[model samples]
Structures are given as structure tokens and as C-alpha cells.
Target: MSPTLRSIVCGVLGLTLSAAGSTAAAAATTIAGEAAPACVQYTAGWRYTFVSNGCDTVQQVTVEYRDGTAVPCRTAAPGETVTFPGYGTSGNEVLGVVLCGTTPA
Candidate 1:
């Protein structure tokens, strides 16, 4: 299997096992129609994982808070996975949007 696929699978498995008692399973969502057809987003607890879908371009991830504040996170190369830690605890009401960007490889 390709590195990207492997990474994505591992992330899914990890999330699945971790969220066994939850009503929903965290799944990877891909962003398409871009020049670089790569990027997956998923959140499990305080950890969010983004995976590249084999594009030559690199993927940049940013987290935008509910207060309209955005924080720059790590960048992941094609077929790689980058994880970001969510702020606050599970009991706290933390809302943030994860933005995925692509750059020319």
C-alpha cells in the first residue's frame, strides 16, 4: 500500500478504537477539485489528523477558532499525515474549523 493510504488507514483504525463508545466514528474527509487532489481531515478527541491523498503538492493545515481566530498548524507532504491537538478538554465547548491548503510541489 502507498504511504498515504497506510497513514490514513492507521488513523482511521486509531480513531475507531479510541471512539468505540461514541455514537459516531471519526472518518476522513477529502477535499477535491483542487490542482492537487490530496488531503483528508478527521478529528478524534483532542487530536485532529490530516492525510495527503498522493498529490505532488504539500498540504498546509490551519485551525480557525470560533472567535474568528486562526492558528497555523503543521504541513504534510503528499501521502503523509499531520496531526494537530485540539484546544481545551472534551467537556469544554470548543469550536474550530480546520482549513487545508495546498502548495506547489
Candidate 2:
């Protein structure tokens, strides 16, 4: 990621963390509910990140990057795994995966 984008992302994350004060517990509960269809990064290297969907339902997710870019949303069946390429540049990293939606299996 470029230094500027990295700084912006860090700043945003910091602000989000600091702004959650008393709502942290509520936010955690909401997040947990929303994360039912979660996809996690199982392995990562310079070139790729492997994401796995361990939920009981089909999940749609997108791979976000540190450079403020993202891969197109993809659907993964329960217990399925997917691979996403990195930004392919020095200092750029995969931020994480975000759930887009879910469907019954």
C-alpha cells in the first residue's frame, strides 16, 4: 500500500476504535450476529491470501486490501475455500475479507 493510503486506513481504524467507547459491547453483539457467515484468512503470503468459509451457509464476501482496493465479491459454499491475489506490490497487503451476504445451503 502507498504510505498515504496506509495512513488513512490506520487513522480510520483508530478513530473507529476510539469512537466505540460505551457501545463496544453492543457492537460486539451486532458484529457477532453479522459475522455468522464469516470468512477468514487462513494463510497469507506476498502473493495470495487463502480464505475459508467455515459457516453453515453459503457466504458472499470480498477481499479488501491495504491499498484501498478490493477484489470482486465471490460466493463460497460452506466449508469451501477461496484464494485471492494481493495487490502485487511491495508494502501492499491484504487487509481482510468482509462478508457481503449469505444464503442457505
Best by TM-score: 2
lDDT of 2 by residue, 9-101 (tens): 999999898767535543332211123233354566778777788877777666667786535456678889888785575788766677764
Worst lDDT run of 10 residues, candidate 2, spans: 27-36
In terms of lDDT, the poorest run of 10 residues in model 1 is: 24-33
User: What overall lDDT, based on C-alpha atoms, would model 1 receive against the true structure?
Assistant: 0.47
After superposing candidate 2, which stretches have Cα over 4 Å from the reference? 1-39, 101-105
lDDT of each: 0.47, 0.64
Best by lDDT: 2
lDDT of 1 by residue, 1-105 (tens): 999999999999999877763422211222222232324444535444333434466655554444443333456676776554554454432243344544432
